[model samples]
Target: MTYALHQGDALRVLASLPDASVDAVITDPPYNSGGRTAKERTSKTARAKYTSADAQHELADFPGENKDQHAYGYWLSLLLSEAYRVTREGGALLVFTDWRQSATTGDALQAGGWLWRGILPWHKPQARPQKGRFTQNCEFIYWGSKGAIDGDRNPVYLPGLYSASQPSGKSRVHITQKPVGVMRELTKICIPGGTILDFCAGSGSTGVAALLEGRNFVGIEATAHYAAIAEQRLRETQDGLAREAETRTT
Candidate 1:
C-alpha cells in the first residue's frame, strides 16, 4: 500500500486533487464544540469522568474556528463539497461528528450532492459522565455515498452501532485519535484496493488503517506538528506490516 501526507489546509489540498481520485473518505473532523456552554462546563470540571485525566487534556488543544453554529455548518459544507468532488461514484464517506453537529453535518452532505445514507453510532464504553444527564457515551458517524447505495451489494456489511473504546497504549498518538480497530473495520467497507482520502488526517490513524488493510491513502493535515506525528506513525505502521509480511514468507 502507498500513502501521501500533505501538511496544509484540508480544503486547499482537497481542491488541488483530481476528480474521482479517491474511492472512500473516512475522516474525524473537528466537532466545533468550543462554544460558551462547552467552555463553561469544561472550566468547572476538574477531570473527565471517563478517565482520570484533566478535562481540558482529554482532547487535542488545536484551534477550532467554528464556535458559531452557522459558521460550523458552512465550513462543513465547503469541506464536504470537496470530498464529494474527489470521491468516485458509489464511494462512501464516513465522517465523525458530535451529537450537537450531527444534524447539520447530514444537511451539509446532502447539500454537497452526497446521498444521505444513515448514521453509525460509535459507543464509547468509557465515556465521560454528566451527573444530571445521560453519559455522553456516543459519537455519530454520518454515512453518505457519492451517488447511490445498493443495499444488497454493499461491501461493508457491519452493523450501524460500533462499540469500541478510544485508542490506548501504543495506538494513542493524537488526543482525539480513534482506534485502529474501528478504522480498519470501516476501511473494509470501501472499494477493495482503492484509494482512501482523509482530509483531516490528525495523527494519520486513517492512513495507517488503510495501508494495513491493503489500500492506498492520501491524508492532509493543517498543523505541521500533527502532520509530523502522523507521518511518524504511518512509517511505524508500514515498517511493522513489512516485517510481518517478511516473517510470514520466511
Candidate 2:
C-alpha cells in the first residue's frame, strides 16, 4: 500500500535498511550477457547488447552490465548476501537471469545464505526465431528462501511458467522492462501487505506492481534518469490506488 524509492547505489542503500525489514527481494539485474566471447559481453553497452540496431525507442541505457562472468558472480553474491540480511527468516528471493547467467545466479543465491528452491521460466512469445538451434525464447527466474518456507503464512499457489511480452512503443520506459502483468503475478509470492525490495528497479515496474497488488515496496535505482522515471511511475500507481480507494469509500 506504500512505497519508498531510493536513488543511489543499491548495495549502499540496502546496507542502510534494517535487518529483517523486507518480506521478499524480487529483482532483475543486468545479465552481463549478449555474446559468447568475453570481449563482446564486457565491451558493449547495455543499449548495444539488449536493443536492436533499428529499434524505435530512444530509451536510455543502464549500468552494471560490463562485468565479466567472474566479476558478475562475485558482485551478485555480495548483493544477494546483503538482501538476505535485509529479509526476514523464510522470506523469498526471485531473481531474473538469462540462460548464460542462470548457473552463476543459483550459485550466488546459495553463497548468500539462501536455500535454493527452484527455477521458473519466463517465456517471451515475441522472441525472434533462430535457425539451426533451439530458439532462446525464455528467461529464467531463480527463486529461493532465507530458510524453510512456511506455506501456511501465505498460501498462494504460484505457477511455474510465466508468459508475457515486453512493453513496446510509448508504454516502455526502461530498455528491459518486464510486463506489468507478469510482475503483478510475481508480487503475490510475498504475504499480503508485506514489503518487497527491488534493488535494480528500472522504471519502477516491480514497485508499481507491488503496490497495485496491495503490497508495500522498497526500491533502489542507481541511474538518475531511470530513477526519475521510476519515481513518476510509482507516484502514478499510488495516485490510481488512492483514487480507487476514495471511490469505494464515497
Candidate 3:
C-alpha cells in the first residue's frame, strides 16, 4: 500500500486506495465554517471576510458551512465509507469536532455502523471567548471502532479532563490547529509501529504527533497550499525525530 503524501483531492485519493488498507484513521474534517450556509457554498465576497484570526487563511476561505449538519453528514458519509473500507477490523477511527457538530457527527457514525467507543474532550483553556455566547474552550474527539470490542485486555480508559493550553497567537496557516500535546496523547492509545491515516490534515499537527510517537503517517488534504505546508511540516517532524535519535545514540 502507498505510504506517502498524495497531492490531490482527499475523496479521490482515498477512493483509489484498496479496502482495509489503513490500520487507524485520525482526522480533522472541515467544521463547515467557511461555507455560506449548510446547503450552499460561500460566495467569493463572503469568502473574503476571513480575518487574520484564522489559523490557516486558505482554510478559512474554504467554501463550506460550519453548521450544515445535513450536508456535512452527507460529505462525512462518503469519507467515513472510504475510511471504513480502508480500516481493518478492530481498528480505530478518531474524529475531531467542536461542540457545534459533535453530537450530530457521532450519531451519523453510529448510523454508518461504526461502534461508538467514547468521547475525549480536549480542553483548551486559552480559547477565544465570544461576546454574548458561552466561551467554548473544548473540542471533543469521538472515537469509533470498526468492530466489537475484544475483551478486558482492550479496556478503554477515559482520558481525564486534560487541561492543555491552546496556541496564543493567531495563525493563517491552519484555522483549527490542534495542540501537539493533544495529538500526541491520542496517538498513545493505538498500537505502536502501525500506519496512521489523516484526511483533513490542516497543518499536519497529527502527522507531527504520529512521527514523534514512532508511527508512520499518511495525510490527505484537498487544498494544494495546505497540503504543501503539511508536507513541509511532516518533513520537519521527521527530521527533528532523526536528530533526536542521533543524539540519544551518541
Candidate 4:
C-alpha cells in the first residue's frame, strides 16, 4: 500500500503524469456553481439549521468554483482528458457532481474519450428538506471506462443507487468531503491492488479509503493547507491500518 500527496493544480499535475500510469481515477472536483448560486443556496438560515457554527465558516474555497458555465465545461473537459490519458485501458473514472452540472460532466467525460457508462446516485438519507420543494438528497457519480472494461461476470450485481448518510461535521476535513464509506464502495469496484489517482483530492478522503482497502494512491491538492491536512489524514489512515494488521497477526 503506497500513497503520495502533491500540492499543485490538478490539471498541471495530471498533465505531468505518464500515460496509463494509474489504474483508476476517483475524485470529487468543484461543482462549479458560479459562486453566486452556491452562496444563494446556502442561506444563513439554512446554514444555521444544518451545520454548526465552526463548520459553517470552514466551507471550502477552491479554484474553479466561480467559473461560468462555458469555462466550467471547458475546464472539466480538459481535466477529464488528462484523466483518460493517465488511466490504464479498461480503468474506471468516477467523478462526483451535483444535479446542475451532471449533464455537462457526462458530456465532458464522453468528449475526453471515455466510454460513458452511467450515473451512480449517492443517496444522502439525512439530507435537509426545503419548504415547498422536493428534498435534494442525492449527488451523482459519473462512471466511465477509459476503454473496454474487462471483469468477471457477477451473477448478482450492485445497484446504481448507493445509499449512505453524508459525513458528519465532526468527521469533515473539507466542506464537500465525501463519506469514507462512499469512497470505499467506489474503490472496491476497481481492479484489486491497483493504483488510484485523485487530481482534485481536496482533503484526501479518497486516498484514505484506497489505503485502507490496500490500494496505492496518488493525490494532488491545489492548496497547501488542504494538502497538508490530506497528508496528515493519509498518514493516520496508514498507521491505523498497520495497527489493525499487527493486531490480527498477534
Candidate 5:
C-alpha cells in the first residue's frame, strides 16, 4: 500500500476524498492555536497558515466574558462531521487531544451522532511531572465508530492507556509530534489492509506506522513545509520496504 502526503488544509482535502472510502482515521489536529502546540512549543518546522499567536489573539478578541478556546469543538465539528460521511459503516475515528479539550470534544462527538466507543490515555513516559497538580503526562484519544454498536463487527477493545515516549533526539519535526509506537498500536486495532487518513499528519508518524503495518495512508497537512517532509518520509519508508522485500526474495 502507498502512503501519500498532501500539502493543503485537512478539512478541504478530506472533503475531496470519496465517501465511505477510508476504514480508519488517526490524527492529532490543532487545538486551533495553529502556531504552537498545547505546550506552547513552537512548531518552527510546520507549514501551517495559522500560528499560536493567531489562535490566541482570535480567542482573546472573541466577544464574550469567557476566554475559553472552544476552537476545537467548532473546527472539529466540521471535520468530524465530514469524517462521519467519509467513513465506512463500521470505520473508526481516533482523535488525539490534551486534557483541556477532552470533555468538550466528547460532547461534540455525541451531539454530532458519533457512537462513542472509549478513550485511550496516551501516557508519555518521559514527560516531567507537573507541580501543584498530578503529573500531566497523559493525553486523551477518543475512539468512535460510524455505527451505534459494534455487535457484529470484529471486537477491538480500546485500552485504558498506552505508554510511549516523547521525541528527544534531533529531528526537524513539529512539537508535540506523536510517536510511531503509539500509532502502531492504534493501527493494529483497525481493519487490516484498510485505508487510513490523518488530517494533522505532523511528521507523518501515522503514515509511517500504517505503511510499516501493510496499510494504506493518506495524510493532509496545512503547512507546506511539514507536508513536504511527510512526503519525503513516506518515500523513504517505501524504499525501505522495497529493499526488505527484495532481500527476502534473494
Candidate 6:
C-alpha cells in the first residue's frame, strides 16, 4: 500500500492532479452547517459551532467552516469539478454532509458533471435524543459516478447504510474525525489496489483506511496542523502494515 499527503488549499491542489488518476474520491469535507446567518458563520469558530459547552477534547478548529449557504454551494461545485476531472470514467465519489447541506451538495455534485446516484446515510448509534423532535443522528453521503458506472469492474455488493460512531478518547485527534471502521468499508467503493483521493483529508482517517484496505491514497489537507498529524498517522499505518507482513513471513 502507498499514500501521499499534500498540505494546501483543496481546490487549488485538486486542479494540479492528473486527469483520470484516481479510482475513487472519498472525502469528509466540512459541512458548513454550523451557522445560518453570515455574521454567525464568519464570527463563530468551528469548535464554537460544533462542540457542546462541556465537550472534553480541545481539538483545533479547521478552516472553510465559515462559508455561508450560498457561497458553500458555489465553492463545493468548483471543488467537485476538479475532482471529477481527476476521476476516471466509472469511478465513484462519496461526499459527507449533514441534512442541512444535503440538497445543495447533490446539486453541486451534478454541477460538477457527475451522474448522481443516491444517498447513503451514516447513522450514529450514540447520538443524543431530542424530546420534541426526531434525533439528528444521521449524516448523509451523496454519491455519484463519473459518467456510467461499470459494476463489472468492481463487482461487490456494498451496504446501503453504515452504522458507526465518531472517534473518541485518545484516538480522537480531529474535531470531526470519522470512524476508521466506517472508512475501511467505504473504501471498498474503489477496486483493490486502486488509488483513492481525499482532498479534505483532515487527520487522514480516509487515507489510513485506504492503506489498511490494500488501496493507495492521495490526500490533501488545508490546515498545516492536521496535515502534519495526517502525515504521522499515515506513516504509522504503513509501519504497522510492514510489521504485519514481516511477522507473517517470519
Candidate-wise lDDT, in order: 0.81, 0.95, 0.72, 0.82, 0.72, 0.94
List the candidate 3 regions with Cα displacement exceeding 4 Å: 1-3, 33-60, 63-67, 129-133, 151-160, 168-172
Q: Return the TM-score for each candidate structure.
A: 0.88, 0.99, 0.82, 0.89, 0.82, 0.97
Error of 6 at 214 (Å): 0.6
Candidate 5 lDDT over 54-163, as tens digits, reads 32222111111122356557767778888777878878888887776778778766665578988899988766676787886788898888885454554666467889
TM-score of 4: 0.89
Candidate number achieving the greatest lDDT relative to the actual structure: 2
Error of 5 at 93 (Å): 0.8
In terms of TM-score, the best-performing candidate is 2
Q: What shift in Å separates residue 31 of candidate 3 from its native position after superposition?
A: 1.1
For model 3, how does the per-residue alpha-carbon lDDT over 119-225 read when each residue is reduced to its tens digit?
88888776679999988678788889889645453454647456677544553356557788878878765567767889878778888888888777888877777
Report the alpha-carbon TM-score of model 2 versus the true structure.
0.99
Q: Write the per-residue lDDT of candidate 6 for residues 1-250, one digit (tens) a residue.
A: 9999999999889988999999999999988887767788767888888888888988998988878888899999999999999999899999999998988999999999999999999999999999999998999999999988888889989999999999888999998899999999999999999999999999999999999999999999999999999999999999999999999999
> Which digits, one per residue and each the tens of the lDDT, describe model 2 over residues 1-250?
8899999998899999999999999999999999879999999999999998889989999999999999999999999999999999999999999999988999999999999999999999999898888888999999999999999999999999999989999999888999999999999999999999999999999999999999999999999999999999999999999999999999
Q: Candidate 6, overall lDDT? A: 0.94
* Cα TM-score of candidate 5: 0.82
lDDT of 5 at 106: 82
lDDT over C-alpha atoms for residue 148 of model 4: 82
In model 6, what lDDT does residue 156 have?
Answer: 80
Summed backbone clashes in each candidate are 0, 0, 13, 0, 3, 0
